[model samples]
Target chain A: MRAFLIFTVFLAAASAEHCYKEIEKACDPTSNKADSTPINCNAKYGAIDGVQSALQKYVNDHIERSFEYLLMSTHYANYEKSREGFEKLFRGFSDSKWNTAIDLIKYITKRGGQMRFPEIDSEISSNEDYEMYELQSLAKSLDIEKTLAVEAHNIHGLAARRRNEFHDPEISSFIEEKFVHKQADDIRALSGHVADLTKLLDGRDSSLSLYLFDEYLQKL
Target chain B: MKSVVLATVFLTCVVFASAQLQCAQKKPNIPTDWIDMASPCVKKMRGQIQEELKASMQYLAMGAYFSRDTVNRPGFAKMFFQSASEERDHAIKLISYLLMRGELTRDISHMIKKNLVVPKTEWATGVEALKDALNLEATVTKKIRDVIKTCEDPKDSSNFNDYHLVDYLTGDFLEEQYHGQKEIASKISNLDKLMDKHGALGEFLFDKKISGGE
Candidate 1:
């Protein structure tokens, strides 16, 4: 009985090795097995290409947001009156956006995807309107948040679509749980903050209101 | 045992035969219009490269001005010449990046045909030259920023942004611009302080200090 068990184990191991060798032969083009069948991975290749292209575009969006925030920071820094609080806020946002871009690139590379760096235009026209009141700047900030939320949604949709098409459960869960849901939560929280700030500033131009808002943002 | 071994070999051959299908596809030719070299942002970058070259020429002219027998400021001449080389290097870097991205036109002769405005060849004083150089650096910084801005999506309603291009610009160029401006500003401040202390004698002392490689 002991000899029989040992022989069974040996036979299984040999069979598995033979299967691995067959897979290796399929991968090699120069192998002269006339009767050998090929396994087409064209569908997988197409899926990868599609996802990579979308991810590249997504990366570009993140970079644009970062640059926009950077310009906003510069405006606050260089302005004669100088709102240091707003400058810090914009700078913080810019850093976050930049990091997000890096994170996305890392994720793509981890998945064996090639990254193509796109050319970017970094000028911000909104920065030219920096002379506007604190309320207006906040409005602009809200607009940025809204745009980011939309982007997050679009990315989520792409990931979900790819998952459905390719039946990639890992990518689906990763996109939905890690990115989509998180972005949605962020959008909700940001919207609430923007609304509260808008309400607080309604019919008020006092330095006190501005100071309070700045303080609130600093805490956030 | 021999029967088991023969059966395994037979299974492996059968599996290989059943799995056979052509995996290799003909290599697709790349489309000529695949890369958008004439995109507004790319065109702006190309123009900025020319601006870099022009800046290099201006620096060279400044170096020549300081090297004149009448000027007799070897240190200033050396500094300006180095600045010129740095600017030329910046232009070359931009060109190389563009080429890597297939954004630059293949026609090298067309790239050579630049309508660069000739830079002023003379400065009334060292202070004047320093101020001009500082201003030029600031302008170049602004131009670089503009290139970055051009990468942004113009359609306000859309969230599409060019992250890759911005990354390249910020990573490769902007830090250097900031540092260059800061250095020039410091030099200007020092020159101003020196002028305040000595008047005509300050200029004489400043020249001597610079010429001594200080």
Candidate 2:
């Protein structure tokens, strides 16, 4: 009887730990005095720094696996698994979180626009016809660079637009022509490096939902 | 005849015990719609935190871009950097919280793509900004706490183990509020001391120091 009772207690403990591994990870050791893991820091809290990583991780791992299976699927079982994963990921958000994420996604896509470039060195000595041909040649050489430059430019424009919309700054000619313009150029310059790389890459294409979900889910 | 009576009594007790167990172990029933609705609030809070982090980073950058030690007072740049880092941590924590809740988050780039600027003409501006930050933190704390309490209210408390989450979030809000108030108070007091020692020179010193970070 004594041995059986001890075994039962040990099993209960093991189960509890299995169930609350994420909560244990986030809990501050010094403050969470009641238990090595606090009961409160479970999936219910849904806050990120607290225990959200664990849940997200759990969701992410299974989703990825489902994706992998779905990618290779020839059977009904695989489809069901993928469907289940998709639904769970979709349903994971509370109404507020879903709306916010959708809004952000919409904002990003909406902000995607053509970014214009400033005129380069107009003073180069050449005949008008020669200059036109030379300009075309220069443009051809800068095809890849220009694409990246455009993206960088657009991203900056988007960021500036966001900033402008936030505070109703007086769109004075001086301010608009000088400060905001300069700021936009600076943004383009800052993102110039990454934009260049993005243009070159053509690797695996993951959906936005999958990417975001996977990033957070792996932690759960 | 005696065995039958005993068996009947045993069956009665078993039924009573099963009923008691059912009452004690009632499964939680969280409202699905509520979860969906509340998700946006969490996302908005996250967006706000991202905005704060961007502001803090801009402040640090401004200090770095413009100031020199001889021109400005000591420690202003360090303070801005510190504040910026803390806000970044706060943003990360917010993301972690959402991830834990199984809510998905896209890149902050989508929500906050622009470089935020904090206009700083002088040293006291940094201090004033810190005070404003503390007030914002306090506001966030209240809002998060209220969210938790609302979740706990019996009227809508059907979600299984959501109460547990509320409890955890409450702890986080308290800790953040403490940090915000403490840092703001410290910066304000430090600024006051600098003012007493150098007057206008002290003020300019702080401006260059913070605006042109060390």
Candidate 3:
């Protein structure tokens, strides 16, 4: 019976040690105090700082592009023979870009990261000819969106790779399922739209093409 | 000995509970990108801020016009100056709103620095200046309405129908804008009638009244 008691005490001590070890592993030293209960900071996940900075820049770029579209709309509105269709189209594009930026900001904040605001250049030069100016603007926007899509893909890839390094299957799957795959599909669709716009601009009359573009954007 | 075992179990439970509580204190996993910074309503608000600043600048110009020795209407000048300050305050409020919502306001600052040209430097008459002021106020009212409309659902499906923004704008701004526009219109009508009935003497007296002189 004495021997049985000694074994029982050893087992209890071992169980307590195991429990304490598990708790210590989860508790973040920076936030957890020795005197108080350990605080878990599992929210700090892979390559967060870098990913956050990139996302912030991406948000800024989207806002800047939105502003550019706004300028384009204003230009079309003010032109001698105002192209209402073009103005409407540009306005739609501006709204779309702005929404995307907001979506990005929302995503970043959801991840427990602070947002950084970027300065935008609002000066846009207007050409004498509305058609040429608008075509150029559309093309410029296409290039910007393409670049943005690539940047987003890269960030997603980085997050995935970091999750792998940390052996964090949950985060890896989350990034893949939530951001990376969806962004890829979105970029592909946007690229197709850009191609369609380019083709339309090349073959059609400026007025009809602009009107069609406005209709197409409205549908989007 | 049985009591000691119960005590150990109780201590274990206590430690676990404390740890769980500490973990629970972690901030809610709010995705930072939840607030759409680029919503149409938000963009309109951003534009409105610039418009407010422009209106303020125009008011300052009107003030300067009235304050001139030849145009000596201290009352009109003082009124314009006050209007200008009020418009500036409106712009600041918009800026604060943008910041609170985590939207960027730096672009407006840049736009103001690079693109803001001076308003009409000289007015032909006090009536003309007041007319412009009325027009400015009207434009601002329309823009505020547009902002409120954008905040409403069905216009932009993506918009969150942010009631707080609607409340802030309609509650504080629209009322003031309406009141200001009405006040300017009244002043213009009164000035016009005084000019018609009393001629140059009426105009002189009106100027004196505006200037706070007997």
**Model 3 per-residue lDDT tens digits across residues B122-157:** 777777788988898898999898888887652665
Pitting candidate 2 against candidate 3, the one with the higher TM-score is: 3
lDDT, candidate 1, B148-187, per-residue tens: 8877653344343667778888987999988878887887
Q: Is candidate 2 or candidate 3 better by DockQ?
A: 3
Q: Where's the lowest-lDDT run of ten residues in candidate 3 chain B?
A: B19-28
The first chain of model 3 has a TM-score of 0.58
How displaced is residue B123 in candidate 1, in Å? Answer: 44
lDDT of 3 by residue, A1-220 (tens): 9999999999878655754654665575655464444332323444565566776677666656665665555455532324466566666766676556545544554454544543333344433222335556555656656676677666666556644333434434655665556556655765675666566555424456656665666566
Chain B, candidate 1: TM-score: 0.75
The parts of candidate 2 lying over 4 Å away from their true place are A1-220, B1-51, B54-74, B105-130, B146-161, B200-214
**Model 3 bad stretches (over 4 Å):** A1-220, B1-38, B105-115, B154-157
What's the CA error at residue B107 for candidate 2, in Å?
12
Order the candidate numbers by TM-score, best to worst.
3, 1, 2
Query: Each candidate: what lDDT?
Result: 0.63, 0.40, 0.62
